[model samples]
Target: MATVDRSTLAGRRDAAALLLGYACAARVSELVALDIADVRETPEGLLVTIYRRKIKTFTEVAVPYGRIPASCPVRAVRDLLAAMAEAGHTSGPLLVRITRHGHIAPPLTRGGKQIGDPHGRMTAEACAEIVGRIAAAAGLEGRWTGHSLRRGFATAARRAGATLERIGRHGGWKDGSTALLGYLEEGDRWTDNPVTGL
Candidate 1:
């Protein structure tokens, strides 16, 4: 199974992006398109608003998990926010730019200002590349892409004893079957255990 360890990444932005993708079980497009305003901390947990480009609908998701490892999704998000604050980002897109040379920079406006770029969201291809790089750095082997993070989350959640109903709700799926077939295919490994037939 391919798992993401945010620590393996060289930059905070990369780590944060990977964590957001994994924890939210969100598409890379959603992750990169997310803005600081899209995140709202509620008493229940963190509420993330996902704007669907295809459907032209907004899906509000609540992440219930708390801080786990240093690379844990929640902690990683906190770290990402802190880094953004340090970079003088008060409100704007959550994920910014990280060059191939490992330099992190904010998106520039059309006027050439350093203000965050509304149109500078990462592409799906870039998202996939980021996932592949993180997986390789973490020593995981599998066919991984940006979609893998969402699949990985569903798979891991199910293996950890989360029911289909719960997983489905968490993923905002209309039905358990949809969640299983669409997002949690990796969880099928559990059904393949030789001991199960014994």
Candidate 2:
């Protein structure tokens, strides 16, 4: 599935966006705000540094290489950056804008200041659209939005018995326990359900 996306400019871009967004629990703004320089390779995994108003200084998060190579965030970002550099992009926003007509090519400069070219930092709406497109392409029959990644991550982690503090830190939320409990409590019904210890 992901192998096919690596075949084109937009495919690679969207693939990287999906995997990285899911793995990092990134907000759409934080996702699109990334630059080529924000990613660096580490001995264990790739470190992505995000600088947002909420996180005044900067935050570095490690994204490991998953067993599935095609779905690995580290590989996806590395490949995307390599493709971008090969296309002459040495700087600027990590995600280049794609047109409504679905065109992807190499015209963006380091800062995407090329005249009349729209390949630049993507908008939040565009990010949502990409997530929807990726979901549909993967044969998911329902609607999905940019927040799905974060939501899905929280659900998956809770199911794996991750503590609220761990989940909050992983998601870059200083105090997300209240919000997470709402999502988790419903699934954690073993304590109240009669089926437990039966």
Candidate 3:
């Protein structure tokens, strides 16, 4: 079946993580380190705070509720939050350990003491694995990782004619970065060079 049973809490959270990762061009560590406190609604859109390891600083970015409902990060995140709230989760890690059976139950039953994720925060390895798994399922061949999302962002943005400076800032790269140099897709956007046209 092409249908997904998003009625399940685990399913909702997974979908949210996947969509948010792509929309934000997130690093795996950043995605797993996310907390309920890091997300908020601003006048512009849904704001996501990403803590960069290289700079050791937090940067907030916005993800629009795209026209496509199925792939919308904003809607996915909102749905996940609602599901978590219903389960008595007010705060803590946004990414959690999903059991083999797809349950998000706390690991400990004694006194209902639940540490964030109970099973513990989702590891970067797990995050990468999920990205690859989802890609394969979508019929995409070749290896994919958490970094793949960032690379995909750069390639797509470049192809769409977004400036390198804007792409660097969006990816949280240091100023005047060549970080995007290797991520460019094979193409010449200026073949119809605007300067020549002018």
Candidate 4:
């Protein structure tokens, strides 16, 4: 996020998206589906309500403040909200597409013409593309999609000594998920390797 220039609206929004998405361990669909009204600020952190299509239910994800102010998800969200409000959008989509010229793109009609709706939420594809674009900008070699945030969250949390059950809950994974267990195994490999301390 340090590489991203927050001086522009697009940059600010991108930073917020990346931070919030990772902090919430959200799928791309859940991340993009969020609205300004879905996030509530608390004294400790943020409470984000996301609808899970897989389970067909709404779940709340708690995102606490980061130790670093620059990389803080809470701060990023607050900054984005302030910028959005200044741009006359106090509600609606939390993440919207901004043109190269920095104006929020209006919604398009089925006829491909711009519609009256000023708050045009970004598509899941666009959000994933943004993740890849930012990673490339940072000179990262591996493929980086929106799912990377979810995986990265699991890996990081495990490394930080978070329990599997807690990690799974944070990521909205089903109980005893094989996919969630895979991350725990991966996390352990690094610390438990026989090659370590060699």
The candidate maximizing TM-score is 4
Q: What is candidate 4's lDDT per residue for 47-163, written digit by digit as tens?
A: 999987776888899999999999999999999999989988888999998988997776767687766445689888888988999999999998899889889999889878788
Tens digits of per-residue lDDT for model 3, 25-108: 788888898988899966556998999777788888888777888878888888988887787776888877766676555565
Off by over 4 Å in 2: 1-4, 52-57, 99-119, 183-198
Q: Score candidate 1 by TM-score against the native.
A: 0.75
Local distance difference test values of all predictions, in order: 0.69, 0.76, 0.77, 0.88
Model 1 poorest 10 in a row by lDDT: 1-10
Residue-level lDDT tens digits of model 2 in 109-140: 56755753344677777888889877787788
Listed in order, each prediction's TM-score against the native is 0.75, 0.80, 0.83, 0.90
Least accurate stretch of 10 residues (summed lDDT) in model 4?
Answer: 183-192
> Residue 9 in candidate 1 has what lDDT?
26
Q: What order do candidates take by lDDT, descending?
A: 4, 3, 2, 1
Model 4: per-residue Cα lDDT at residue 36: 97
